[model samples]
Structures are given as structure tokens and as C-alpha cells.
Target: MPSQNEPAEPLAKGIIPTAKQQFHDLFVWKQRVVITNEYGETRTEWVTPEPLQNPISLFMQLSLKGWLYFLVGLAAWTADAFDFHALSIQTYKLADHFDTTKTNISTAITLTLLLRSVGAAIFGLLGDRFGRKWPMIANMLVLGLLQIATIYCATFSQFLAVRSLFGLFMGGVYGNAIAMALENCPVAARGLMSGILQQGYALGYVLAACANLGVGGETETWKTVFWIAAGISIGVGLVRVLFPESKQFRQKADVDESVHTVSAKMFLEEARLMLTREWKMSVYCIILMTWFNYYSHTSQDSYTTFMLTQKQMPNDAASRASILMKTGACVGGTIIGYLSQWVGRRRAIVVSALMSGFLIPAWILPRSERALSATGFFMQFFVQGAWGIVPIHLNELSPPAFRSVFPGVTYQLGNMISSPSAQIVNAVAESHFVTRGGERVEAYGPTMAVATAIIALGIMVTAALGPERRGSRFELARRAGDRVEVGKDVEDVVMDAEKPATVQREKMDEIEKK
Candidate 1:
């Protein structure tokens, strides 16, 4: 340890931020600057940000290839969301078809959530070790087959079994999708792209609700939504076959070839080293994801049932309200995600969480279709607005070599921990009663309100205390002796070389003197 009179050494990479530092970072906008040493090696340092760039200009910075990668990743994620929400939104129909209680039907959801961690572990490692393309293609194709299998289930047990299998495949999509989507994105464009990308979930929900609306309220019509979901998943998989592996992955492979052949032993050694270094970050991310999973599932899964039972809305009205709700989510996620670039990620998340928490009373109190639709829209806007920052936030924090596994495993493990959220809500709502118009009803409104409030508070606190690495470089590769270099590809190094050299000599001189 340094003497009290001397300044302390800088914290190692991935060290947790102090509360004071976290608070400062919440409001600070650091500019990413490159510093080249005498030996012609470069590393990034964060200082005061320069003048803000136009959002349009930031978007224009992406090459055509970058846009294609982002779009394909978004499509895969949207299809995955559509497949999962198809079941959640149609829970009542499935229960009636199976001649089972709503809680029992929700068991399928619980099983699906519980098993997703396994898929994440398997596929995330596959994505990190192999190329992202084949693992994602396999995940999407298998998910489509599972969706069709779900439609053919003759028994509730079979339905549960199929959904469990579905969960396993579903867990793999998020890691690869976001990794491929944002890995090549310019630092300035990341927040905007991340926002747009995360909204694929809301868009999927909207599409599923629209399908449910079109097919009408008949018990058997849920099959049509499942079919549509299956088509979308299969279509995305087929489309992915046309694209080459992500440029970053290809570059990494080339660099690895020079150092040593890419093999299982090398991959495992890297993974073990990463875990030893980053276990704390991994644990923190998992906790954050657990709160987020609970926040979304508890507020959303049984909302249609809540409207039908407690608010006395018809199926069509409830479906419309749900569609409007997710539409708000799509809009909010995009807008807030964009604003996070300027306002800072954690501040954006904390503010959105608090705002959504405040809106809970209005969210649950509305009875009429128009009233409920309006409130639901605003509620989801803030709820998912906070969520909009998640994709890029996780990507920024991830270790460069294991981006796929780190985010995916943390997210799915969180999903595993919070798997029973919907079931818990259902059981509690059914067991407890609330009075509406002098009649008793399942207490979904109160249940959701209380749960959402607690979750919102949790998000605010967790995010406020967490560390951020908002513009860390991703175009990295390992050199000899496992030293990671900032630019791997020839083109990238050339680009950096062309930029003006304004090295922060004072900082370097100070470090040398110490």
C-alpha cells in the first residue's frame, strides 16, 4: 500500500466503483481518448467529453456492414421474444384448453425460465469458442421446431415438457444477438443501437398481441400465434445463413492463429482466467439481472388475466390494452436509450425506474379500455425505458474475449433465480381477494403494484451503486504472451494512426515519476 501522503495507485480494470465514484459517474460524460506510447502501443483513457455529436451523424458513422449485422441480430432477438411471449399472453387460453388452473399453466413458464440458464451456458460458450453464426442459427432453428412441437402437445404434461425445451433454446439468443449487434457499432452509436435492439422484445410482444387479437378469443386460436412465431423464428434462422461471421470474431480468429491455434484448451484456459479475474463483476451482473427479470415478468405475465378478471374487460379490450402497453415500451426504450448517450447510463436507468414506480397507481387503477390503454402505455414506457440501457451497458462491462458468455450466463442465471415470479404472482393473487364494485376478485392489481414498486426501488439502488464502462473498446485481440491489444485488424490500426496524436503526456509523465 502507498503511504498516506502519496496518491493511491489506480484501481485495476473491473474494480467496483466506490459510492462516491459511482455518484460522480452517474452524471459525468467522459470522452474516450487514445494514448500512444513511444513503442507505438495505444490504450484508451477517459477524460472530459468533447462537444456532443449530432445523433444523426453518430448513426451515419456506421458502415453498411455494421447496419446489416445490427438488423440481423435485432431480427433474431425479436423472433425469440415473439416465441416466448406467445405463451405468456395466451396463458388463459392454454389453461382452459388443458383443463387446468392458471397457476398450473404458469408452471410451464416457470420450467421454461428455470432451464434457460442451461441453454445460456451451453450456447454462450459455444458462441464465444466457435463463431456466433452457427450457434445462433442452431438456436433459432431448434426454437422454431420446438414451437411447432408445442402446438402438437396432446397433454398438459407434454405442453410443459415442450416449453421447458423451448426455454433451453430461448436462453441462447440474447448473448449472441447483442454481441453481434453492438460489437462493431461505433461508441457514439452504441446507446441508440442498444435501445433499438432491446425493443425487439416489446415489438415481439406487440406482434404476438396483434396475432392474438386477429385470431379472436377462441381457446384453440392460440395455435395460430404459435405458428406465426414458428415461421418468424425459422425465417430469421434461414436469413442468418446468408451473412458471414461478425468481423470482430473473424479478426480474433486471425490473431489467435498467429499466437496459437484456436482450440478447446486455449478457450478453456482463457475462460478460467477471465472468471478468476471477473467473478465479482459476474456476480454483480447476475444480481442486477435478477431484479430486472422479476421486474418485467411480475408486471407483465398475467396482465391480460388481471384485466379480464379484476377490471371486467373483454378479451379484445384486454389484448388491445396489452398491445398499447408494449407499444409504449418500444417507444420509451428507443428514446431513453438514445438519451442515455447524453445523460449517462446509470442516471437514465435510475430516473426511469423511479418514474415508473410513481406511475404504478395510475397503471393499476384504470378500468375503461381507453383509460387502461393510456396508463399502461406510460407505465411500460418507463419500465422498459430503463431496460433499454441494459444491452449496451452489459456489453460495455463485459470482458472483451468472453462477451457472449458473460452477459448471457449472468442474464439467464438471473432468469433462473426469478423463474417463479409469474407463478408467485398468480398464486398470491388467487389466494388473496380484493373488492371491486362490492364483489371479490383476484388481487392482481395490488399484487403487481406492490411487486413492481419493490422491484423499481431495487433497480434504482443497484444501478446507482454499480460501475460503468460506457465506451470501452471492443475491437481487441490477444498478442503474444496473452497481452490484449486495442486494435486487431489492419484497417482499425490504420484508422487510429491517421487520427491526430494528442497524447496526454502529463498523465504519463506523472506515472513514470511515481
Candidate 2:
């Protein structure tokens, strides 16, 4: 150790936010793959591990049903959001009622997403501070009510105002639902499970598209879609009331009162402290990766709308495109879950994000509507579809202190970064791209392609340096200076079959490697 007066040497242990006074105490029951003793020898625990026991046992106990439940909740939440996009059509209806331009409808969805992102910050903090269930319940209830209320709007402004309000709750169910799944499930399964859960958003989008087709193209038809969403939200909310709090969050509560919890104020302060040079190295790496993955997701929103209009497609066609995108997104989620099992969620996420940046744009630029729609489906399926794995990856890596905040905040930060993306893309697609005639011939396709490349580059960067919490025992991770680690949703159980047969002792956090 260096003398007090000597400038401190960079320690092997990275990202210390004020040498945690009793940091080891925090890992009392968390899972682990391999642990270090005071003598510095690696020890592996073999006791029958269960949820809240050690990371290994916690890892083992995550059943398929648990993952399925998370998926159901996630599906309901995302589907609600997907359906809200149909409001873009309804937005025009409200405009037309007052004899306004139909184009205003397209803008409404953008405003809604912006509002939803802001709300996620508030509710995400709420999920961390309070329990995850109530916030989820509140989101579903509020979203349902808003869906019903959307039909009653008579003015374009009224429609805009209502939809914007609706957006506030758009991602509400998503954040809490993720927390619930992460907190309740085992560490190994967190990545794939979270991905499965998140696919609900994509599913909702597909379902909404089908509903739009059935409802047909009328001002009244769009109103009916909102009613359908409202009913679904209410039904899901009611079901949520019966779900229990996450077992993971509960573990933190059983600790000594003095070491029990960090206040919300302290939470924010911790996040600030987390920004120090040491932490920034790792966090920034993840942020960059996230920017790429989410860039694809957000740009897809713009691409779907742009392509349909570019095709001069009817409302029903547009609706079908939305459904196809959602289905593709679901495929993306499923693919993430399946592939992350082998490639690892972090690697898979980075790969998918980077590749989606390439493929998602392909969905838009095709010469024919059939080609465009097919590309959109595969883009979401292969590139963006793998998006579902992130929740699992993020949950496994993050410590309890930050779990509630990181994923949603990280996702939203990407959204914020991508905010100017549309305008930049619009400039490039329309005015920036030159043609012999100097006329706009639907710049949507190329814009999406460019956006895809940027997102892909982001994924590439992340793969190079992002943390790997996949299948690594959490307790051993902490002692290994892995505190800042943020794991993934695609359950990395590659080691499940490799577990060691013996153990001598357990540490503050029980970790064992096969």
C-alpha cells in the first residue's frame, strides 16, 4: 500500500465511489460464481443454492414460467405502447375534424414518445425507491384510462394534448416490469428472461396493427383502437395487483438498519459519484453500446412511418407495416434470448445493435411495398428483434443500488441522443440528398440505412470493452473489482452444467464456479 502522502496509485479495483465503508456487507446473500477468501484463494460454494441464497442457487431456481410471466407483463406493456402509435392515425382524425392538415397525425407519435421518455425517468426512480409493482399497476391503469379517453377528442390540439399525456405512461409498465422480473428471477436467467419480457412491447405493436386492419380507416375506427388498448391496460393492471414484489429487492431490506438503504437523494448523489474518471471508463463504454442499440429502435419508429407514407400506402397498409415491425421486434427479442445463450447477452446485444444498424434501414429502402414490409420484419426480427435480451443483461450486471435506475435511464438517454436523429435524417433524406431534378423523391429509405450504420458502430464499440457479467457469479465478481458490472437478461447458464461438486466455505457473498 502507498503512504498517505504519496499520490495514490491507480488500484486494480476499479470505480470506487468512496471506498465503500462496508461494501462487502452489501453482498451478503447475492449470487456468485467464484469467491476469494481473506487468504486470497478462490472458493466455490456447493450448498443447495436457492433464490436469495447465493448467486448460483439464485441462478438455478429461475423457472421457465417465471420467465413467461415476465414476458406476459412485458408484452402487455409494450403492446400498449405499440397500439398508441395508431394514435398517429387518430391524431389526423382529430385534425381533420376541424378541417386541418392530415400530416399533423404523424407528429403526434413523436411527441408521445418524447413524453414517455421523461416519464420513465420519474417512474424508474420510483421503481427503485418504492416497490416495482405499484408503479407498474399505476402505469397500466393510467394508460388504460388514457386509451379510452383518446376516443373522445374532437380537436387536433385536443388529440395532441391527450396523446402527449398518454405518452407519459407509455413506458411506465416497461421499467417496473423489468425490475420485477430481474429482482424476482435468478441471476443466470436474467438476460434471456428480460429479453422475453421486453418482447411484449413488440408483440403489442403487432397486435395493434392487426386491430387497426380490423377497425379499418375511419376517424371512429382509430377511436375504437384506443378503447381496445384501454381495456387491455386495465385488465393487465388488475392482474398485476396479485403479483408479489421482487425477491431480490426484499433481500436488501433484511440487512442492518444502519446499512439498509440509500435515500433517493443519496441515490442521485451516488449516480453523480459514479461519474468519476474511474467509473466513467466503464459506464461510458456501456453508454456508447446502448446508443447504438437504441438508435436502431428509435430510428425504426421514424422509418416505419416514413416508408408507409413514401409508398403512398393507405392507412390499412400503414397499419400492417406497424404490425410487421412489431412482429419483427418480437423476433428480435426471441433471437436475443436464444443467441445470447451462446454468444452472451452483452456480445449478442452489441452484435445485434451494430448489425441492426445495417439491416433495419434495409426494411425501408426496398423498391416495392412487399419488399419494404418484408425487410422491416427481418430488420426487427434479426437486428432489432434481439432487443429483448438487454433487460436480462442489464439486471445481472447492475448492483442493487443502481438496478432500479440504470436500464430505463440508459435506454432513455439513448432516446434523448436520438431525438435530433430524426431531424438529421430528415435533412439528409430530403434536402441533403441531391437528385438531378432537385426534387424530393421520398428520402425515407436512405435515411434509415444511414441511421442503421451509426447504431451498428455503437454495438461494435461496446463489444470491444463492455463488461461481461454473463454466467459470472456475482459475489466473486464484487471481490474481483466487478462492482460496477451490469449483467444481461439472456440468462448465461453456460456454466450451469459446469458447477463444481465441492465447497469448503462461503463469504459475504457466496460465489462458485463450475
Candidate 3:
């Protein structure tokens, strides 16, 4: 592979057919390079980086890449468990598998919940280190097996261990998937991309709920869902084998690693540099927004079915409510989320997060079950809408080389903050709020709303303080006006063009295949 340490020089991959010149739009606006040809001039007139001759061409470049990775991200995030409703109905049977008290079996679920953060950070690092393509593939296979392994465990300890391990693999699926989505999309498309990416979590619940309803939890084949999980993971893994490595990762790996001696000290130094006093504020904003996102999915979503049952709704009805919540989430994440791009991500986050404050308080309404479900749908659509920006917003804040670390850490940190809250809240609700014949309302519902509102405040704060990267990064920091900032070894860490490299250089072929 050739060393491309130069800022303005071009290198061609099959997608990026020619090396893009070191052109900097120093004007700090949203437009591509366009040079017009004049007919009557004796000397050809030269115009500096004006807007593109055709902007849609750039759109195509941006869209095609973003869309491809988004599809992959969807598959990676599609395994969320919504069978908590079913589990409640079939608690006795599930307890039998653990060979312990039902409470103990119930407690083991914490293992699965906590470990996913661990997986996200671990696999996220691998995505940055080796490449996004292979770790993702391997993670799928492992996660599938772990899901299947969930079925045959003879002891609660065994089940907990397997779930924790499964979470580790699933973590990779998400953290890397987010990194992949950012590398592929244009800056303009990021908010939408993040919104779309967040929808995958809701979609996973839909899949799990449908399966739970179909299986009905009574058959020996309730374990069949794991089979489905396994099959999909394996299938997706195969497809990802042919998936393109980001031109960015390949470029860096071909030359030298962006990071040397991946130690805590070096990591801190790099983090300090990235999170300058100004960037520190941005990091906090990322943390706050991420806090809501992490809690909403893990704590709130996980407990909805439990809450429905507690409220005296039938199992089927409760399951339907959870499904509807996710349905609302999918729609909200995809369509209404456009506000982030228009209002600016900061205002969009504040407005959307504040909606959680209103909707969550509604859960306390004295109302019919149907009315409660409607409010659930409303809360998910808007409160969760704020979360959709996280995927894109966080990525934009991170420089390329530290991409995997920051996203992974934020995601896990959010999970860590929220998961225990889910448990503690569950315990508190059980102790104090028992109603309807002393059967506590599902622990996830009311507590989740409260949890999310507090976290939403954090998100709002982050948005106010974080760096805004609305246009080309090169121009935003004036890095292009002077020189690219990466060290010779670090330059390749994030040099992706919105298109594939087409020159088909034999360089890095084996590295790519491996």
C-alpha cells in the first residue's frame, strides 16, 4: 500500500476513482467543488471552490454509502428482547430452568442487561483496531450461539454467564455499527442517519415481541427464538464478509496506526487533546444525550411489558402495548426526527427531551388502560426522538482516530448509569408502589419515565456546550486552510471520501481480504 501522508494528494480506491485534490472550501459553507468552463475567454477563467456544478451528484455520493451501512446497522441491532411480557406469564416455567428460587432466576437477567455495555466497548475497540468488517461478522456468530446457549443452561449461574457473554457480543454489534454508519454518511445526512440507526432498537423489540406472541411461551420451542437469532446473526455475518471496510480505516491501517501503545495513559492524553476545555463541554453534552438514550432503551423499554401486566391488562394486551410503543418509536425516529437538522441539533435535543418531561408525567394519569397505552406511544415518539440524534451527533464530535473509543465509552457509560437504576427502581417500586391487590405496577413504566426525564436534562446540557460541526470539518476548524492535522502515521485514520475508491490499487488487498 502506498503512503498517503499528503493533505491535498489523491489516492484511488475502486470507489474514489481518482485521488481528490487537496481542495479546501475555506469559505466555511455547504457546497462542493465546482469549476465552470468559459467559451469565449482567450485565457481559461479560474474560479475558486464555488458550489458544485450539480449538488445532487454529491448527494448520490453521500446517500449511497450511508444507506448501505444503515442496512447493516439495522440487522446488527435487531435482537432486542421484548419477551419480558411473555416471561412474566411463563415465570414458573422459566424458574424451573434456573433450578433456584424464582427471584434468583429473575435476578439473573441483570447479567444480560449489564454485559451488553461491556460488549459494546470491547467490540467497538476491535472495530477501530482491526477494521469494522470482520469483528462485526464474528460478533454475529458469537451472539447467535450465545442466544441458543440461553436455551440449554441447567443452572442460573450458567444462564447468567451465557447472557453476560451474549451481551458482550451484542455490544460489538451496536458500537461498531454506529461507527460504520458515521464513516459512510455525509455530514448533512448524519442526524437522519442517527435517527434511522436508533430505530433499529425499536425494530428489534418488534421482532422479539412478534416471536413471543407467535411462540406463546408454552411450547418447547420458545427456545426457537434463539434459533432465529442465531440464523440471522450467521446470515448477516456472511453478508458482512463481503462488506466494504471503510476507506478511512483501510487508509490508516495501510500506512500506520493512529494510536501507539493502546495504554490508559496514551488513551487519556488523546482524550485530553480531543476534549479540549471547549471540547470538554461538548463531551458532557454527548454524555447527557447519551444518558437518556441508554436509559430509555435498556430501562424503560425493558420494563414496559412488566408495567402493563402490573396495571391489570392481560398478557396479550400488555404485549401489544409494548409493540405499539416500539411502532411509535420507529415512526418517530425516522420521520419527525427531521427537527434535529432544522432547529439545529442542540435546540432539537432540548425541545425533544423536554417532551419526555410532559409525557412521562402523564403515565401517572388516572385513566383507562387504553388511554395509558396511547400516552406510552406519545412518550416514545417524542422523548425518544431526542435520542435519535445521538448516533450522528456524537460521531460528528469525535475525530476519526478516536471514533471507536469515544462512542463505545459513551454508550457503555450510559448503560452503566441506567442499568442499575432499572434494578434499583424495580426494587423501589416493588417495595412502595404496589397497587391493584398489592401487585406492583410493572416496574419499568413509571420509573422509566422519571429516569428518562432526568437523563434528558443531561442531554440538553450537552447540546448547549458541545462543538457544533454543521459543515465540512476541514473548514470548520480551518485545518484545510492550513494543513491536515494528523501525524504522518495518523493521517489515514479518517480519510474516507463519500464514494468508493475505484483505482483498484493492488495495495492492501490481502489486508482487506483478511
Clashes of each: 0, 38, 18
Candidate that would win on TM-score? 1
**lDDT of all the models against the reference?**
0.83, 0.56, 0.55
lDDT of 3 by residue, 156-256 (tens): 67777876676566656766777776667665555566677777777777676676556664545457656676777777777778757866545443434
Model 2 CA lDDT for position 322? 65
Candidate 2 local lDDT, 1-514, one digit each (tens): 2222222222124434312311331222222244333454544332222322333453457676575556556755665665565554344344555576434454565566567667777787777666677777888888888777777776668877987888777756556667666555655565555666767766666666687789876766666777787788888888877756654344343334342333455445545544442255436534753565355544555554464445556777766776776677776786577556555555566567656656654665565667767877777775554567666666555543345555566655555445445445544555544232454465666666666776667665554444434553332211101122123111112122112212222322232221
Looking at model 1, the pairs that clash are: none
Candidate 1: TM-score? 0.88
**Alpha-carbon deviation at 195 in model 1, angstroms:** 0.3
Candidate 1 overall lDDT versus native: 0.83
Stretches of model 2 off by over 4 angstroms after superposition: 1-35, 38-72, 88-107, 249-286, 289-294, 297-299, 357-362, 420-441, 472-505, 508-514
Q: Distance (Å) between predicted and true CA of 137, model 2?
A: 0.9
Q: Residue 15 of candidate 3: its Cα lDDT? A: 17
* Model 2 CA lDDT for position 149: 73
Q: What are the models' TM-scores?
A: 0.88, 0.71, 0.71
